[model samples]
Target chain A: MAEFWMSEIIKECARQRISLAEYIIRGECENSGSTREQVIEKMGKMLDVMSSAANGGLEAPIRSNSGLTGGAAYQYHQYIGQGSSLLGTVMSSAVEMALSCSEVNAAMGRIVACPTAGSCGIVPAAVLSVGVSHQKSREDMVMALFVATGVGMVIGEHATLAGADGGCQAECGAAASMAAAAVVNLMGGSDEQALHGAAIALKNMLGLVCDPVCGLVEIPCIKRNAIGASTALVSADMALAGVQSYIPFDEVVTAMYAIGKQLPAELRETGRGGLAVTKTGLAMYETLFGTPMSL
Target chain B: MNATYMTGSYSVFDITGPIMVGPSSSHTAGAARLGKIARILAHNSVKKVTFQLFGSFAQTYKGHGTDKALLAGILGLNPWDLGLRDAFSLAEKQNVEYIFEPVTKPTQQGWENYHPNTVRFLITSENGEVFDIVGCSLGGGKVRIISLNGILVNFTGESPILVTRHYDGPGIIAAITSILYQDKVNIGNMRVDRKRHSTTADMYLELDSDVTERVVEEIQKIPGMLNVILLQRINEDQSLNNIE
Candidate 1:
């Protein structure tokens, strides 16, 4: 086992004259003891799952088992189809796709847990929407996924990705960061820009709580994923335009860890505080489970 | 000196996948993996199972589909199987009776201190053998088998393994390792557990690769060996007959 840093990865890529995705692929092959073809084959399968999940709820309205979230993605897609979106085609499709994937997850449809199931929608939405709008090939999308994976691994190593451990900042925030980096790479941004994009996205989401109402991944989780996708796009856009963060990517990750540790258990997916304990949230829980919400 | 972050133990896909039916990775997908591993450990003869949910597993299992996911796995369904959505009916069709018990307080002494996402499975086999196994879903589709039949042990089910029950006696570990050595099967890790003054002990060997049928037969033939079961790595493609 060796230490992995974004700076070292960038330096290695430059020295080898390879792209960030290629460097990650080579390292993954060595780590997993698999061949390049085998690693790519697995990544290809992941892209397929992401594609299906992103499209799962778009064809028709699907309701969550708890009846908490349903048809929002479909409604948004319909709205976009009517040319009513103010965010333009690319950003609108990102939100729509993010909602679709999150809704599908709530409905128990198969999905790739890009970091996690609760935040699964963000990365695929960010990657696939941009890929489709820009006419990137499937290979290009898979490479972008590798880029996301690289960023996620760093987060997982330095901090956490579980809402239970680090709140929504760790789940959706990390997904947005990963998605931002992937988008930068997809748009031909430099490795430094990709890392900067990740930093900006995560910095904006610091201290977000993970208060899933009734402990379900329906209400805030689904909507947050939609917003997460849009945030990733905005961050990537900023990075591509040469915007920079004063704090480096690793420092931001350290700050996120510090902030996460400061969060009380009530805000860490316990359904005991924040929006989960709101009057409406408690009422919904009582209606669904036929029991009063208790700590 | 710079701090290193690469553990080489986790693949990039580990952070990215385990393509599954999802609402929560810890509650749904990891629960399923735990159930499937328990089934394999029981030699797939499970006729009835009682899942005792603790902490987070008890509080949110229903909303997260943890109940259905556990049943689906015991019925031999992979996490990615669409049939997981119909696990209840599928269990009924297969005559697999099930129960879910939520525990807020310790039912017995020494029951405290379990992980927040722990479940203890009480399984009855078709042959009327009853055993209890405890597991924890450590978020992101990762699970650990913490105890089997009251013998405390630990393994992640990420690699091939052999669980054996044998008489507690000298030369037992040596005999098993020698057989594995002759077969050229590398041992990644191993643990042996036994109760004081008991005649029996359980040995768990996590292997880097699958062992051949001949190797299993040779180990089983050893004097004082009671049972030998081989479980494939749960992270890989699996079927009911993964055991020999």
Candidate 2:
């Protein structure tokens, strides 16, 4: 509550002999002047919004106005239901849900950005998928989301969340880290283990650039949400199984910020470099806008 | 980064901006909110509106639907409004004259005080009332109304904002606060911006809760008070939930 650094968060959790979610709740209560019950109730509404987004995408996949993304979430669901996925129920379903949220976003439907709209799918996909698979109670899931919020708050304070500033690493990358920590907490891992999951997830995703084709939140953005979800699941499993990150969560975040600072402006959501300037990407851009992109 | 963001005063609502219809929060949602603020300033008397976009918005407003988003907002639609897609045609049908002009800036940071996602609205009412406002979309579907009629004023669409234009004099602040106190409405925060050596000033207040129409009427009745308008709350009350 006194500080927002990951180190301070972990220390507060340990010093208070409380779970990470409880520490987050107390801090939120102090910071926002809201009661615990109010915070929990608000979180519940967010969960409902996430659920509705996924369900809407699955029921009838409306193509985004860009026509670049649609039906993939439902298709993924169908593919997962066929039992061909090696990721088992939790991870594969997470991917489907992740796609669902991104597709909904691309279609201009309602969505909650766990950090940013570009990466909205990552946290909801992981939390809802795992919660559904385990039939976890709403209270438990809300607690897990609080843990995720704590991780996100630390990253937002230390690094960045906007793709324009940091790149895809700050968007999808930060969301993946939050999802990983939430997954670990939901699975009954220690608060330290949850932070480790976050570190591992973020360490692996460092330097990822933001390069959506045609300056739209489609193409790489939607699929990347799915990948981000799976990565979070794997990282959370590793931490829950006693794996550790060589770099702590705070250090990993610092590295991400440093790398993001060095990234070319073209690679940081400018849609001028990386995959954005590819021949096909340019072709699609012209077809959509009726003019050639100067890049 | 500003001092407020640094202090970690951001609420949970800010994590993803507000839950709304979105493709790009910075381009669409933020633009709409800016338009909404301009509409409020125009007192819904806007007959003609011209939008000048700069920086990232100028280059990609079409693809991101920033044009439609802003127009929809001036028509009093929020980001979640499904009717945003039809905003252009709706404006024409409503007989609201509008034009969108893209201005090229050498950098996202404009030559002077322009932010990356900046917009200027020149709104003219049917009664010949003109209101010109400049705003910036600070990404994540957040917007800050930076200026009103060339006067430097800062307001983010976070709470119930009361924007008042009044003549500068003693007891101006106390008069407003007294009426608010009588109504049991708390002042979350407030800021006063005045012209140098001038009597005209702007008072921006973020109230703890929504104010009754009568409260605005009372404030308007005060001496030296020129105008009073409530920049309606955009995001719904997520602070308290009825679910037990």
- Largest DockQ belongs to which candidate? 1
TM-score of each: 0.94, 0.87
Q: What is the DockQ of the complex in model 2?
A: 0.39
Could you give the interface RMSD of each candidate, to one decimal? 2.8, 3.9
The global C-alpha lDDT for each of the candidates, from Candidate 1 onward, is: 0.87, 0.83
- Give one digit per residue, the lDDT tens place, for model 1 in B1-244: 5322243335788778868888888899998888888898888989999999998898888989999999998888777777878999999999999999988887673443668899999999999999788999888888998878776666787677788999999998899999999978899888898978889999988899878878889999999999887767664633411311
Q: Please compute and give the TM-score of the first chain of candidate 1 against the native first chain.
A: 0.97
Q: Taking the tens digit of each residue's C-alpha lDDT, what string does model 1 give over A143-243?
A: 98988998888888889888878999999999999999999989999889999999999999999999989999987999999999999999999999999
Give the lowest summed-lDDT range of ten residues in model 1 chain B: B235-244
* Kept native contacts, fraction for each prediction: 0.67, 0.43
Best by TM-score: 1
lDDT tens per residue, model 2, B1-244:
2111112545565673366666888998889879987898888777999998888888888877788889999998877676778898999898999999888745343422568889999999889999989999988788898777766666786677788899989998899999999999898888898879888889988887878889999999999999887766655453223211
